[model samples]
Each structure stands twice: as C-alpha cells, then as structure tokens.
Target chain A: MGPIMDLTIFGFLVQDGLTTGAVYILLAVSLVMVFTVTRIVLVPQGEFVAFATLTLAGLERGDAPGLAWLLVAAGVLAFVMDLSAARRRGSRRGIAAAAVLFLAVPAVLAAVALYGIGASTPLAAKIAVTCAMVVALGPILYRVAFQPMAAASPLYLLIAAIALHFVLVGAGLYLFGPEGVRTSPLLDGSTEVLSMPVSVQTLLILAASLGLNLALFAFFGFTLQGKALRATAVNRRGAELVGVSADYAGQLTFALAAAIGALSGVLIGPVTTIYYDSGFLLGLKGFVGAIIGGLAAYPAAAVGALLVGLLEAFSSFWASAYKEVIVFTLIVPVLLWRSLAHVAVEEDHD
Target chain B: MNRRNKSACAAVLMGLSCLAAGSAQADITVGVIISATGPAASVGVTQQRTVPLLPKEIGGERVNYIVLDDASDTTTTVKQAKKLISDDKVDVLLGPSLTPNSLALIDQMAETGTPMISLAGSGAIVEPVDDKRRWVFKTPQSDGQMARAIIQHMTSQGIRSVGFISFNDAYGEGWAASFRSLAEQVGIKIVASERYQRTDTSVTGQTLKLISANPDAVFIAASGTPAVLPQATLVERGFRKPIYQTHGVANNDFLRVGGKNVEGTLLPGGPVLVAEQLPDSHPAKAPSLEFIRLYEALPNAGMRSTFAAYLWDASLILKAAVPEALKTAKPGAPAFRAALRDAIEGVKDVVATNGVYSMSASDHLGLDSRSRVMIRIENGGWRLVP
Candidate 1:
C-alpha cells in the first residue's frame, strides 16, 4: 500500500486526469462528428494525432517531415482516381478544379514542409505547417478510399477504417522511425493551487480543449455550412436532394476531424512522450468515451471521457499494472446499460 | 555368393559419394532472426545493421548470414526459427531481439541440435543449464548482473530503502524478480513498487505514490525511450533524490527525448556506453573503440548502440569457434553442427566489444562484472561513474 490518500495528492491526480481527459474529449467530438456524417467509426483518428506531433517534432529538428511526402502520394492517388472518374462522366468540366485540389495543393504543402521550415522556424508556424500537412491527408484519403464506398453498410466502412488505421500506423513508423519523441513544452513553468503543483502545459491543454469545443458548438448551432453538415448527418439522401452536396459534407467532416486530431497532438505533445503507435491506445480511450454516448450525444461523450481520465488517474495510483484493464473494462458495463435502455427502439438497418 | 558381392559393391560406392558430397561444399551458414520492424525495432535495427560488418570469412571458410525479420512477434520468431533450421539448415542461429521471442526459440534450437546466440537481455534464456537452454546463449548482460551492480553502488552510497517502477511486461517482470531477490541479500527494502505501460502518457499517480514512500532512491527498470517518462514526471513533481534506471536507456535517443530532466540520473550499462572513458588498461577498451569506429563509418549509422555491440561480439565468437568446429567435421553436416556447439562451449577469454567472453559447459553467457560500467547522465552524455 502507498501513503494515506491526502487532499494534495487528490488535487494533483485530478489535474492530471483533466489534462489527459481534455485531449480525449477533442478526439471524442471529432469521432462523433465523423461517425454521424459518414457512418464510419473513424478508427484511425489517433493516427492524425500521432502524425501531427511527429511532424511538428520533425520540423523542429529541421528534418523534412515524412507526412509531407505521404500527402503528395495520397494526392497523386486521388488525382488519378478523379481523372478516371471524369473520363467516365464523358465531360471534363471540373478537370482543372480537381487538378488544383488533388495535386497542386499537396505538392505546394510538401514543398513548403520539406524546404521552407528549419530549426529556426517559429513554433507557431511549425505547428501551422504540421496541421496543414496532416489536414491535407484527410480529404484526399476520403476521396480515394471512402467516397467510392460511400453507399456501403457501416460494418464495411468500419472494416475499411480499421484497415486504414493499420496503413497509417505503418506509414507513421516509416516517417517517424521507432523512436518516441517529446517536444519542447509550449508553457514551461508550473503554479501551485492548494499546495499542489499544476504545470502550465496542463492549463494550456484545458484552455485549448474548452475553446475548441465551444467553437465546434457554435459552428454546428449557427453557421449555414454547419447546418448543411448537420443535414447530411440527419439523412445523407435528404441532404443531397436539398442542395447540400454529399461529397462536400463528407470532405468537410473529414477535414474537421483531422483538424481536431492535429490540435490534440499539438497540445498533448509537450505533456508526454508520444510514438507512432501511441495514438492507437489514446484514440481507443476516446472511442470508449464516444461509446458512452452510444456514439451520438456530445455532452455525454465528453463527460464519459473525463470520467475515464479520472478513473485512470486514481487506478494508476492504486494499481498501476492494471490501469489499462480497469479503464477498458468500463466499456462493458456502459454497453450493457445502453443495450438495456435502447432495447425498445432497436431496429435492424444497414 | 554373387548377390552378396553385388550388395557390398553398392555400399562402398554410396559411402564414397557421400564423402565427395561433404567435401565439395565448404561454406558455413548462420541464420539471424531480428525484430527489424516492430516494437523491438530499435534494438533489432541496430543488430541488423551490424550484420554486414561481421566477418565474411571465418577461419578460411566462407560464412553466409541469412537475416529474417520477426517483427517482434513471438509466433513469427518460431516460424522463422523453423524455416532457418529446417529449410536453410543454418549451422547456428543469432538473435530474435526480444526476451519472449528468444525464450520461444529454445525448443526449436534444442530440437534441431543448433547453437544460438540470443541478443535479448534476460537471463532466463540461458539459465538453469537444462537440456533445452544448453543450445542457447546470449550476449547481453543478464538483468540479475545489472541489478547486482546497482545494489553494490547503493550499498556503498549508504542507501537503505529504494522505490521501484518498471514497465508491466516480461522485461520489467524479469528485472523486478531479479532485483527483489538480490536487494534482499543486502538488507535494502523496497519502500514502494509500481508498474506502468510502455505507451502510457503520464505516470503522475505512480510518481505521487513513489514520492509519498520517501525512499532513499528510485530505480526504474525499463528500456528505450519509454523509460524517460517516469523520471521526467518525478523531476517535474519536484523530487530531488537520485534516480536509477536500468541499462535499457543507454541509447542516444533516450538522451534526446529526456533532455535536461534526465540530468544527474544514474544507471548500470555495458562498457560500450562509456568505452572512451574506461581506463586504458581495461581489456574492453580497444575493442569497444574499434566497434565504435567501424559502426560510425556506416552511412547514417547515427550513434553507437550497445545492442549493435552484442552482435559484433557474436561475430567474434563465431570467428574463434569456426576453425575448431571445422577441424572436427565438414561443413553442412549434422556432425559439423554438433562440433560447432562444442567448440563454442570450449571458447575461452576471447576479446570482443562488450567484454572478454569465456564460455563453458555450465555457463553460456560468459561475461563477468567487468562487462558492466556505472554511468551517470551528465551534460547530455554518458559519464563513467568512477
């Protein structure tokens, strides 16, 4: 047994829980958004987080980020697919637009990431470039791997998502190597609250999570584009008939997911060490949070993720060896409860 | 009478043809199983890179190395081992970079009557001198040896109680078991012990628990970059006591990832880590420097790793034993493999990168206390703790 639990220890554990929980919350929100829109579980959501951090570290080291080259590769694939699709349509009306979006954008980003950045580059710019490179990967991947299968069942989409997760993990290893990296902290010092030390990085994480969630809330509630996305989520065919392009909504949703994942990487990079495979576990934790909402409600998912963080924190204190087991075991009870509660509304549909 | 004479003639011809076939092929084959692409890639990649640098011609006979990637999976290791032994008919086997994979290989080695030099750092691979482990040997110092060094240093420093944290895996469990048994002999009590996963983002709770115990020192038994988190977390939480880590963090990446937070930490590692700092009279100095020079000459080799040295030492063992084995039997024969195993066992005081190995029937891992060096993290580099 450890020392008797005291208030100071409790305070520190809470702080640790909230900080990690915040990152999971961002992941959960993005997951919910992507799932509702595309009917895909977005299993590789954590790869984006891993890639963003590794790319940022690469930029800081003056090594050309590998994701930039990956972006270019994905762009080339998407471009070829677009050209073939256009040929089938018997008209080249949008050929130029497709070329610019699917080819030129990625090439430009890759060039900037490879040659423009250096160790002397400012931190903010480095983060921006990392996000841009990672964000570019999303829509191109959606175009190449997902859009053609858009009409498939959610089961197949989930399978495809899991496959994509593995590809990204392999690519991550190729880009970042097997070494784990920890970036320089965005905020370096700490302040004491109730005699418990709270790192500035933790504070930064909380603020970023709160701000991103609020922004997302406002986007979904007020903006016309947001409504279109919501419309697509409500009913894909209905939204397509009402002048909301399904392709546009899907791409936009993927871009949002990528952005949230990238931002989470940036915030969490300084707080802990991250490797190419680290995101799978982190993303799985967020998936647990999303499941707590039955994969729908935003607030419930956020609260569930926070609870996971707290439980992980406290459990690690008492039984660090079984922390993961305890955290993952949470989903079984939640699933059972949801199954019982929603039994009446159950209906079999693709 | 005519039928018996005809059968005798046929038997004589078959014996002559077999002798001719054995004499025609004079090359030796050594199969290497490395985890070049998975969780153990850091260790495997280095060992793989060292492959080309091994002796191409041992004892005037050509040596061929067939390297296969196990991807750090135990099942793959067994599959590859079978392929190497049954298909390739390798004379000896090397590596399978992780502990569990190495343990999985003992049965295959024993079944095939092959000698194996494992690069994994656990004593379980070669301990007990059982029928299965007799064919297995390893280059890395056992966790028990490193634990003894750390305990000796603690005793001399007047440290009474210690805190312990390690990864929740085979490697950590091995260290915990070894350290627990060894530390008890010295009357040093463990005030607290905790385990964390390799991919864990934070160890705040573990750190808090360890701090509350108020031990004289904290020892973390983990390897690679994952080992950095607990020390960094402890330092961030304002723990000023000395922290001891296992030899797993001897690589350059650990220093790069840990940065300033790792300063003043101490660990016991192979002599390869502080080769240049050793006294000139030390036996391992010259070979260690030679390994560093050769490894650094490779393009994009980065820093010299202890894991690579393990492979280099394995090569040295082969170079010394091949001639003896060749003297007894022809290459590509079961008799030749049996001879090679015996030759390796009889090897004595052969100088190489990590230490001078002296193998015997009872001991396969032939390094002594001279193989380990006390290291302190200072000024972003390893400093020999005098």
Candidate 2:
C-alpha cells in the first residue's frame, strides 16, 4: 500500500496479468470456434491441452519409454479407427458419439503414460503420446460430437461435457494418485539459458502463447470456409440450398477448434502445472474470456482476457493471497454491465 | 553330589536363557508419517528412504520403526497418525511433514501426550499454542530465522538493491513478510517485490519487473508447484545477479528443474548445493556423506535429494529418546507407547548424521543463525564456498 495510486506495484501486476490473460485468450478463442460450429459448449477442449503438457514434459525428461514411431503409429491407428467407425455407421450415424470419444483419447493416453508406465520411457514416447492424441483429437471430434450436435441446441451437451471432464480428472487422480504429478524442466541447465527475467521476455512469452491461441481461432473464423459454417449457425436451410455442406462445415469447425485447444495445453506446461482437473478452471476462464470479448469477436475475447488478467495481477499485490477469489468476484460487475447492455440493445432493435 | 550338580546346572541354564531373551528384545519401533502418494511424493521419497536407517547408523539396541504413508492428503494423514500410535504402537514419532499437516495433528498431543518431531519450517507451528504448551516441536528454524539470515547476508554485501518474489500462500506470505521486514530493518530497499500463484508457469514477468528495478540481488520465497518459476525466468532473461532463495528450495527437485540455472542459488549454512568443495573437516560433511553412501547402497532411492538428510536428522532424534521410553513398558501396545514418549523427549547430546540436535521445552527448532553455512550450486554440484 504505497500511495493512493502507486504505479510501482500496479505497473508490474498489470504486465503480469496481461500475460496470464494471453493464456486465457488462446483458450477462449478455441472454445468459440467449437461453439460457432455445433453451438454446443465443449468442456473437454481444455483437458486435451492439460494432457498435452504432461505428454510433452514426459518426452522432454527422457523418461517416456517406447519408440517415438510407436506413438506416431498409435495416432495413425486411432485416426483410422475413428474414421472407419464413422464410415461404418452409415458414414454418418453418430457424429456426437464419435466426437466425444476422440476428445477423450488424449486424456486417457496421458493418464496411462503417466501413472501406469511411470517415468520409464524417454522423450520419444512422450512426444508420440502427445502427437498421437493431438493428431487424432481434431479428426475424431469433428466426426463425432460437432457433426451430431450441429442440428440441436448444444447448451445441454456442453454442460454434460463439463461434468464429464471433472469426473474423468477426479478418477485419474484417484487411480494414479497425486504422487508423481510434480514436474521440473525436462532438460537441465539448458532451459535456464532460454528463460528470460526481463519484462520484455515475460510479455513476449505471454503474448506468444496467447497470440498462438488467437491465431488458431482466427484460422477458423475469417478463413477455412467460414461462409459455409456461418450459414448453418444461422440460415441453416438457405445455406444448404445454395451449396454449403453443413455436415463437413460442422466437422471442420469442431476439429479445428479442438486441435487449437489441445495445442494450448501442450504449450501451457511452463505457465502452470498440469493438474488432474485443470480444465475446469481453464474452461471457466475461457468461457469468461469469450464473454468479455462479446462472446463472438476473436480479438475482443483476447483483449477481455488481457484486461481480466491485469486485474487479477493487481489484486495479488495488495494481498499476495486470495488473488483468484478477488479477481473472480470482480468479473461480476463487468459481466452484469455487459448483460444489461446486450438486453438494452436488443430492446432498442425490437 | 546329585543335588549340587542339579543346582549348578539350573543356574547356568537360567543365565543363558536371560541372555537369549535380551537379544530378542533389542528391536526398536519408531513411527514416521510421510507423503508417499501425493504431490510431494518426490520429497516424501527422502523421508521413506532415510528415517528407518537412522536407527541402524546409531547402533541402538534394536531398531524397529513404523513408516506410514500420509498419501499427500490431510484427512488420510490424521488417520495414519492414529493408526501408527494405536495399531503399530511406535515408541517415538518423527513427522507428518508439510506445515499444515504438522499443525493438524499437533492436537493429538493432548490425548496421546506423545513426543513428536516435525520437519517443516512454518513459523506458526513453533509459536505458543495459547502459552499452555510447547508440545509441538519443529526441526527447521522458523521462517523468521531464514529471513533474518538472508537480510544479514545482503546487508553484509553492502548491496541496498533487492528484488523479492514469492508464491501466494501462507508459507510464501510469511516468508515474504519476514524477508521484507529484515531487508528494511537492515536499511536495504526491496526494489520490485512480486508474487505469483502456485499454478503460474513462468516467473518471467515477475523477474522482468524486478530487473526493471535493477536490483543488485533477488530474493525468492516460492515453494511447491511454482518453485521452478523464478529461477527458470531469471536464467531465461539472462539477468545473472546473485539470487538468494529461502530454505524452501533445499529439495533437489528445484535443482533438477532449475538445472544450470541452479548455479546462482544462495541458501542457508552459506551454500550447501556446492557440497563437494566444503572443507573436509566441516561438520555438515559427515551426515550428508554418510546418508548418501547408505542411500546409494539402496536400490529404490531418488536420483539425489535433500530429503535424505532431513529424514536422517528426524530419525536420529527419535533414536536418542527411545531407551528411556522402553524402560517401564509393560510389553503391551498402550503401555509401550506411553513409556517410549516419556523416555524419548528426555534425550540430550543427540548428535545426528546431520548435526548435533539439542531440544528443550523452550527451544524446539534445532538450527539457528550460528548453524547456517551459506553455499551455492557451482558447476552442476554443491560446493561450500562461504
């Protein structure tokens, strides 16, 4: 508590928070991509990322075991298994069912590789596990959950996925036990040379991490046959009548979005630990980040995350503990204002 | 003649039988609560591997110690402590590690009246619990001691510029306050003091902020998950000032994570990470060297960690207290425990593999200002250069 308005603490905190915001921004944009397609809130997206970091850490540590090729083979096998199943189910039968399973594979592999195998393998095994899971996730989720949920209101499904994600994480912790989750840099002194202590480095890491996430979402939005997907989210019949293949658009959207989410998870290791139930926090933050960005604007969602992150950082300075509690509480007023603003604009239009 | 021979034979037989019984009764039972299957498992491995061996090295009559897994969960830890006391009926208790867990079970002291030694440095644990009792004793000095030592070193360096970073928790908060207060007390300025949550990945932003302040040194008070953040960020930014870390980083896990970045870390007792360079005559050498030798002989030990030494220390204290505990035991569970606690806490001149440990109702923490030997991590190993 330096002065009424001491910029010293505030300045540092804001910068710290902005970097945190970047992580949220990346996560939020990925979620928005999935929502845009199926309109179903997806919960497993964050878990995919959480598991990715674990796999990467394992690989870097040289304790993952098994040949790297084997993991790559596993990815190809899972992809084939998913596609063949879809092809068998009338090449169309249960998109949602298949998508759910695809999203789940990475988490399952991560749990097994971590607890069942322990730290026996090497870097290749871990990379294989991560690649196999990530490579398989996009193609499978697109074929399964997104394609099926596109025709229905997806709010319920999103809620169900969130619940399921927690259950899985809880079960993993129980099964694996929390004994071996602690991680260090995969390699030794070499990592030290890469880490920077200056504000510029901190800002860059955050921006890069956050920017990578936003770019993935942007890939889905303005590019990648956006016209075909938007038609289905709104003018479903007219878009189809013109030439949009609603089925493929739904598949591409979910696949693209889920891939980005999983990618973020892999990169998030140095940012924080990969806990069993880290997704719940990430999902909530990503959702809030999406809301902050007007729930649809990619850049806006990212900005919202940055602002929120800064706020969280400042609160930490005043009281080093309870940073999360203070920041989560602060979001209420901003959300309330935005909600009211939305209703007012709607009424004006009406 | 027959009467004389029979009497003599019976006496001889009786003497031999007594010797046999004495040899059989030589086994000792001490109890230790360690987190085997939880977040701290890496550190817990240290306790599991070292505590049981303390009895063997000291050549106690017979060493039988109970090692219970706390499962890294609090509720399970209390139940395990009760089990060790009631079921196993150990003579003395070593630890339930972590500050919070240690505080949780100190309540049992009222019921069991057992003499327990904890390995955590949480300052609040050592403070009077309403001044009625000092039953709870900690081996590591309170966070205040660590803070004071660091501030003194910084002052001696004549460096007024400092940067402080800590995780956001009770442990970190207490450590930060002590460090800052001591810094200010010594007429030193904390240029950029920043904190992060345990969940944060990088301390890059925080380090940069401190770098911007251009402090001559950085003091870190982080532990657990975010333990790697500051050093990693500091090294990454290539800002190679002298960094003083709290004893929170004594665990080798930080070195494993921090790697070559570990070279600059300054800690208690001068610098311990630079172990090889310590004078051959230094007291610290015997215990750590002996423990490492014993651990290396065992197949299941960790790559290398400070946990081994910490556990060895906790066990040696319990061994010093065991004999008096067994003196009046009735050879039953309840009576055996009662006798052991009474005997164990009365220990004096208990020189452990770590160092000489002496305790009283007034002072429980073993190490203080005089004990510190500052060292650093030099060329990928510990060399005492202080």
Candidate 3:
C-alpha cells in the first residue's frame, strides 16, 4: 500500500479520464433527455454537438472575447429553431432533413462572417450580410419546409438527421480542406490560450457547456412551447382536445431538438480537432449513453457517460486493446439481462 | 449449317477477349492490403495518402497500386492478398499492417516467395518464425529494439523500478514480455504488472491495481484512442512520476487526445521533424526535408509528421532496387520484378539521404544503437533530451 501510495501514471490517467468523461456525460444526458421526451432515440445527438461547436468556434475566434453578444444571439436563434421543429410532427426523414438545414444555417452564417473578416471586409458589412441572409431567407425557408417536418417521431428522425449532418460535414470538408479548421480557429490560438493556467477559463468552458445544455432544456421544460411538447409526447389526442395545438407542439419539440443538436456541435468543436467523421462518432457515443440512461432520463445518461469515461480510463490501464470490445460486450449482456429480468417480472405479475 | 455458325461465333468472341486482355497488360500491378476502416485506419489512410506521391522518376515504372481494403481484419487481409496475387497478379506487395494479419501471411509469403514490404509497426512482422524464410522485411524496428530503447532510456533517467500496464493481446503481450526481459537485462526491475482486456474502458480496477503496487516509472504499451487516453486520466490526477510511453503512442492524434497529460511523458524517437530543419551535412536531415516538402504538395495532404521521414527512405530504397531488375533479370515486367527482389535482398550500406542503411540475407533490422534516438515532451512538443 505504501508503494502503491507513490505516484503513478495510471492515477493521472484516471483524473484525465474523469474530465473527458464529464464532457461525455453532458452529451449523453442531453441525448437521453431528447429521447425520453420524443420516444424516438436521437442517435445523432453527438454529431449535433460537434457541429454546433464547430459552427460557433469557427466564427471569428480571434475576436470571440468581444463577440459574447454573438453567442447569445446565436443561442436565441437556435432555441427558436428548436421550437419550430418541435411544432412539426412530419415523417422522421423529413424532420431529419429540416433539422440538418436548421443546424447548417448558423454554421453558414458564422462562416460568412468569418470569411468576410479574413477577406478584409468591414465588420458592419459582414454582419449586415449575415443578418439579412438569416432573416430574409433563413426564416422564410425554414418556416415553409422544416417547421412541419420536425414534428415527426424524434427517434428514427434522430438517425436521419445525423446522416444529413455527415453530408453537411462532408461538404464543409470539401470546401474547407484543412483550412476549415484554420479559417475560423476553433480556440483563439489554442497553444497560448490553453497554456494560460487560468483554471477559471477551463471552469468557464465546462460550466458554460453544461449551463447552455441545461438552460436549453429548461426553456423546453418551463415555457409554453415546452408544455405543449410534453402534451404531445404523453398523448397527442388528449393534448389536442385540451387546445394544446398538438401539431404546433410537435413542430416545437423537433425545432428544440434540432437547436440542441446544433448548439452541442458548436460547444464541442473547440475541445477537439474537427473532421468530416467527427460528428458520426460523437453521435453514436451520445446515442449509446442516452440509451444507457433509459432515453427519457437526462441525468441517467449523464451518469452513463461518466461511467463510460471511467470505464474507458480503467480499461486502457488494464486491457488497452480490448477497451472498446469490453464496453460493447458488457452493454449487450447488460441489455440482455435486463430484458430477461423484465420478462421474469411480467411472468410473476401474470 | 446454323450449329456451325454458332460455334464459329463463340470461338471468335473468346479469341478476341483473350487478345484484348493481353493488350491491356501495360501497367505493372502492386497490391496493398491497407486498413480502410477500424481503429488503425488512420495509419492505413496515411499510407494510402502518401504512397501515390512517389514520382515516376523514383518508382522506375508507375504500377497500378491495387489497394484492397482489409478492414483491419485477418480474414479480409488473407482474402485481399489472395485476390491481389491470384486475380490482379500484382508484381510486388505492401502491408497487412497489424501483427496477427502479418503473421497469417508468413506461410503464404514463404510458399509464393513474394518479396513484400509492410508500412506497419510490430517488430515481429519481419522476424522469421523459421530461418528458411527471409522473404519479409519490416520498415520499423523490432519489438526487441523497442524494448531495449524503452529500458535504456528509462534506466538512464534513473527510473530503476518501473510499472507495467499493457493490453492483453498479441501486440501488448509480446511487448510486455520483451520489456521485462530487456529491463531485467539492464538491471531495471518491474514492480507491478497488470493486464486488462481490449474492450474494457473503465480501467478503475486495473489502474487501482497498478497504482497499488507503484513503481518509479510506468511503461504504457498501448495504441488507439481507447488505450492512449487513459494515460491522460492518470496524469491529470497528479501522478508526476516519469510516465514513459511506447513508440506506438507517439503520433499527433494521441498527443492531441492526451493533451497536457502528455506534456512530460517520454516517447522513444523513431524520427524527429528536426531533421527537416537541419542542413545537408546532418545525415538524414536533407533528404527527409525534401520528401516532406514534396509530400506537402500532394492534394489534401500536408507536412504533418516526423514519421513520414521513414516512409521517404523506404520508398527510396525500393526505388534504388529497381535498377537491379534491368541488370540481373530480363527486360520484361515479370523478370524485372524478380531482379528487383534479388537487388533488394542484396542491398547493403546504401547511404540514403538520411543515414546509412544496410540490407542483406540475414540482417533485417536496419540500424544499430546510433539510430535509436529518444525524446521527451517539454511544452506540448517533443524535444530530444541530451
């Protein structure tokens, strides 16, 4: 025990694992919440966060300190997009398509603004162009096409949405190449910024990430749109009879889910290097974590992610190669066990 | 009369098809069993990305790189290798990256006598299971060399007693055993040794197991995201003891995922980017830099790694071996390929733009003690420690 008490790399590894796990936890929980409300698993949740992070971080990151207002504005727009999608209860595929476009809007706007900055265009002109495009074209198109599509089943729709996300990412990769990462710099000269021992900044990054997710959830839960979403989720006919406007509520929930997916991508981008495939992997992990948490339970998925992280850390130390194999193997057995137990309980009830 | 006409038509059609096939045999075919997906797909992707840029001036002749995706699976590797050889009739071969896949191909290599080179890691890939077979050659150092390098570096830094953390696979087990042997040879003791399976991500039990027995430095012999990131977890928890990493975990992706936790970790040097910044007189510096510059210009590729230096040398050796095909064997494709193999086998002391490389009948390992350089992370970048 005394010798064990001496410092070791595995100890440090466990700590790092926890930190990364914390980030995963948030993603897992958000995904789980969306799944719980809609009954459709949002398998694409991970990719959404990655894309949103890339979108925001891809903005004029050099001036990000001053563009605090931009984030607020983007968040509100994203939230509105969420509400609209929630109002729609269209086919899963159509909703997914609409959601993909909704997420892309911010990234495109951010890209245009950043491109303008790079090309020596005046800030006012960039913002003017951005605002005009977003308002004049973005909302009009979204209202017509995406709003209805989103109200459909959230589960299968989640998968379709993520596949659409991959296409967008692929397009971005084709257009940006390696420079896409550079065009808007995810973090302000990461080497310098990351080096500064401002634990406060790290805390803020983590806190803001968590807070934004929670705040969005709160908006959905506390607001009238959120109430409508609940009514649609629990029972459509009853909610409609209660004058809840079930169709509108459906659209609002889809819109909210899309917004969450987009904002998540924005927050995650600065933490890791973005690539065409980044979204897909994150989406999968988030989906898995969501499932582990019973889909409807946000806090459970959060815990599941931390569990994944902790397991990952331990697995690396013990069986590095089998880390993934072990996690998946356990997942299947656990699920099988649960299914068997459920059957047994049903038999007892009979 | 109708039957005769039909028979005549069939004969003519078959004859024409055969003639067309022979007419299209202008390009030399070379097969690469590359990993297009899975964990090590990045390495395979890098190879696919880099191999095409070899100029015709260097390649002697442009060959159809019949790259078949192995999916990083053994069955896929075997099937792809068979198809390339039997179906594609490839002139030369490269890669089936992982150890098990490489080992699986040994009997095939011996039977076919195919002169193959791998753009893979796994010290055991080229090492003979039996002395009669010497057809395989590996571009990277063997496990023995890697273990020696790790032990030597750690001991020199006064890390006498080290902890062992490795995956329980062929790759990991081989390294773990070799490391213990190498460490014991140098009078270094391994205090705590723990083994874990590949898929288990929560190493809490394992890490706790290792930390419980604690040693001076911990040797993490692992690869891919699942294996490497846990080291970061250990570091962040304030474990300051020297955490020495295997050569496998020395890439940018690993460093990126590990972040500051990797700042002080030591990595065995395979090739450093400093070679690019150096002048001509410095052995490998000039040629390495030239390759980097040329490779950077490849569409969608850039100058990103120090390891690409070895690849440059590997291509150069193969290129220089081409002239032997003209001299020793006949002028045609098949004979020239036969000569190319012999020339490669006979290569010795050919001063590459980098350092002196010697290849022969018995010697598979390229460089001796002078070649195995070591480096450590200072401020998020790898720096050679004197």
Q: What value of lDDT does candidate 2 attain over all alpha carbons?
A: 0.60
lDDT of 2 by residue, B203-313 (tens): 444665666678899888876434666766676657788888876676654565566666767776422233455566656556556666777677677455555566666
RMSD of each: 6.7, 9.8, 9.6
**TM-score winner:** 1
Number of the top-ranking candidate, with DockQ as the measure = 1
lDDT string for model 1 (A108-137, tens) is 999999888876789999999899988888
- List runs of model 1 lying over 4 Å from the truth: A91-95, A344-350, B1-24, B86-88
TM-score of the second chain for every model: 0.92, 0.81, 0.84
- Pairs that collide in candidate 1 are none
User: A19-121 in candidate 2: lDDT tens per residue?
Assistant: 6677777777767766655566667766666656654665566455232222333335545566776787766655555444443454466566545554555
Q: State how far residue B156 of model 3 sits from its true place (Å).
A: 1.9
Model 2 DockQ reads: 0.16
Predictions ranked by TM-score, top down?
A: 1, 2, 3
The candidate 2 chain A region of ten consecutive residues with least summed lDDT is A189-198
DockQ of every candidate: 0.71, 0.16, 0.12
- Winner on TM-score between 1 and 3 is 1
**Superior candidate under lDDT, 1 versus 3:** 1
**Model 3's DockQ?**
0.12
Candidate with better lDDT, 2 vs 3: 2
